[model samples]
Target: MAQAQDMIRLQDVTFAYEYGDPVLEGVSFCIPEGESRVIMGQSGSGKSTILKLLLGLYKPISGEVYIDDEPIGPCSEQHLGDVRKKMGMVFQDGALFDSLTVGENVGFYLIEHENLTIEEVEERVRQVLKVVRLEESLIDKMPEELSGGMQRRVAIARALLATAPKIMLYDEPTTGLDPESATQVLRLMHQLTRERNIATIVVTHQFLDALAIADKFILIDKGVVAFDGSLADLKDSEDKRVTSFLEPFRASLRLMEERRFV
Candidate 1:
C-alpha cells in the first residue's frame, strides 16, 4: 500500500516494445510528495521509458504503476485522463505550437478542459508565466517570436495552467541550450519543486543540471536500475557500472581544472 506521502510508485514493473526485447525489467521506485528524482542513462537505456510508463503512454507488461496511490494498469482511458490531470510533462523540445500566441498556448488546456472564461484563462496564464519569470507582454507574441529559453519557460507555464500538478515529468528539459540558459531552466525547475511542493522526475544526460535539481538519483543500465540513491551516494559509488557511467563527466571536469592552471 502507498503511504499518503507517496505521489508516484512503480512496483516491480516490466515493459517492452511490440515484438522487441524487454526495455525495463522488474524496475521499482517511488517519489514522495514535494521531492525530485533524476534519472540518468545512456541512449536507449530505458530512461525515457520510465517517464512514458508513468504517464500511462505505455503500460507495463507486468506489475503495477500507481499514481496518487491508485493503480493505473487496469484504468480506462477516462480514468487515465483523470490521473494525468494530476501530472504535467515537459518534452525535450518545448513542444509549443508555432501557430498560437504565447497566451493561447499557455492557456490551451484550461480552455479545452475547464469552463473558464477567456478573461479567467488569461489571468491564470499570466500567473503561471510569472512563476516562470516570463512577462505578460510575451503572451501576445507568437511562439517563434520568443527565444529558446523563453519558449521552454512558456512550455513550463503551459504545463502548470490546468491544475497545480502534483507531479512534473521533464524529459531533457535543458537540452539544446547554452549553459546560462540551461541554468535558468534548472533554477526554474528547482523553484517550482520548492514553491509548489511538486514531485518531479527529470530524465536527462545532463549530469550537472540533474545534480542541481535532484533530491534522489537513479541510473539505468540495460533496462535495470544500476544505481538508486542520494547524490552523495552516487558520488561515492564504486560499482563498476556507476564508475564507468561517470568517467566521462569526471574526465571533463579534470580537463577543465587542468586548463584553469595552464
Candidate 2:
C-alpha cells in the first residue's frame, strides 16, 4: 500500500520493447510528494524509460505502476488520461510550438481541453509564468525570442497552467546550454519544487545539475537499479558501477577548479 505522501510508486517492474530484449528488470522505486528525485545513468540505461512508465506512455510487462496510489497499468485510455492530468512533462528540447506566441504555447492545453474563454486562459498563463519567474511582457514574444533557459521555463509554465500538476517529469532539462543557462534552469526547477511542493523526476547525464536539486538519487545501469538513496548516500556509494559512472563528473569538477587557479 502506498502511503499518503507517496505520489508515484513502481513495484518490481519489468518491460521490453516489442520483440526486443528487456530494457528494465525487476525495478522498483517510490517518489514521495514534494520530493526531488534524480534518475541518472548512461545512455540507454532505462533512465528515461522510467519516466515513460510513470507517464503511462508505456506499460510494464510485469508488476505494477501506481500514480497517486491508483494502479494504472491495466487501466483504460480514459483512466490513464485522467491520471496524466496531475502530471506534466518537460521534454529535452522544451517542446514548445514555434508557430505560437509564448502566451499561446503556455495556454495551449487549457485553450484546447478546458472550456475556458480566451481571457481566462490568458490569465492562467500569466499566473503560471509568474510561478516560473517569467515576465508577463514576454508572453507576446515567440519562443525563438527567448534564451534556451527561458524557453524551458515557458515549457514548464505551459505544464503548470492547466491543473497545477502535482508531478513534474523532466527529461534532460538542461542539455545543450551554456553553464550559466543550465544553472538557471536547474535553479528554476529547484524553486518550483520548493514553492509548489511538486514531486519531480529528472532524467539527466549532467551531474552538476543533479547535485543542485536532487534530494534522492537513483542510478540505473544495464536495465537495473545500481543505486538508490539520498544524495549523501550516492556520494558515499562504493559500488564499482556507481564509481565508474561518476568518474567523468569528478574529472570535470577537478578541471573546473584547476582552471580557477590558473
Candidate 3:
C-alpha cells in the first residue's frame, strides 16, 4: 500500500465570483493519495468550484487549498506552475486545441515548457496514448475527426503527460457521453487510478458517471458539505438532498431490474 496523506484538501473554504453570491461556504474535505473521491451535487451547487480552488485558479475567501500537503496560498506564478505540474485537470469538453492533432495536443505541455526535442515529445505522446488505450495510429489525426469518447480518452492521455500527476481532477467527465462511452471512460478512470496510484477527484452532477469510480463519495448541497462517506453510507443516508440527487441512480437501477425480467 502507498503511504497516503491529505494529497488534496479544502479547509473552511468560502469563495464566490466577482460581484456574485458565495458558491462555497465553509466547505472542507480531504482526499488521500491512491484513493478516489466522487464529488456530487446538483447543477450550480459549487461542485466545480471545489476543483478550481484546489488548482489555485481561484482563491478562497477565508480558507486554504492544499496539494500534496502544500498550501496553495498567494504564491508566484512560477511556484504555482511547479505545484500544478503535480496535478492534471481534465475539463468537461475534453479541452483539446482545435487546430492541434491528437499527438500535438498531448505533447503541448512539453513543447511549451520543456526543452525536449521533437522526437522526444512525440515519443512521450505515443506512450501516454498507450496508457489511455488510444491507438498510436491516431497520433496525427485531428481532434474533430475522433468520436466524443475517444476525445475524452485523448484528454486523459494529455493529462498523463509531462509527468504522472499525483492528483487527477475530472470535471463532468461522463456528462455528454452515451452510456457505453460513459462506462468506458469511467472504467478507464478506475483503471488509471489503480495503475498509476493517483489521487482522483471527479466533479459531476450525473450520478451514473460516478457509479464506476470512487473510494469515497462526497455530496455538496448549497455550498456546504452535505455528506461524506462510503457508498454504503450514501445509500443509508436519511438526508433528503443526498436521496434526491441519487434518484437518477435509483431510477437507472429500477430500469435495469425491469429489463432483466423481460
Candidate 2 per-residue lDDT over residues 1-262, each given as its tens digit: 6688888899999999899999999999899888888898889999888889998999899999998888998899998888999998999999999999999999998988999999998888888888788889999999999999899989888888756888999999999878888877888788778778888899998777677788888999999999999755766789999989887777565444332210
* Alpha-carbon lDDT, every model: 0.88, 0.86, 0.85
lDDT of 1: 0.88
**2 versus 3: better TM-score goes to:** 2
Compared with the true structure, what per-residue lDDT tens digits does model 1 show for residues 217-260?
89999999999998668878999999999887875643433322
Error of 1 at 18 (Å): 1.2
Kindly list the per-residue Cα lDDT of model 3 for residues 134-182, writing each as its tens digit.
8999999999999999999999988889557999999989878898788
What is the TM-score of each predicted model, taking all chains together? 0.94, 0.94, 0.92
Residue 221 lDDT, candidate 1, scale 0-100: 94
Number of clashing pairs per prediction, in order? 0, 0, 0
Ranking by TM-score: 1, 2, 3
Between 1 and 3, whose lDDT is larger?
1
RMSD for each of the candidates: 3.7, 3.4, 3.6
- Where model 3 places Cα greater than 4 Å from the true spot, the runs are 1-4, 254-262
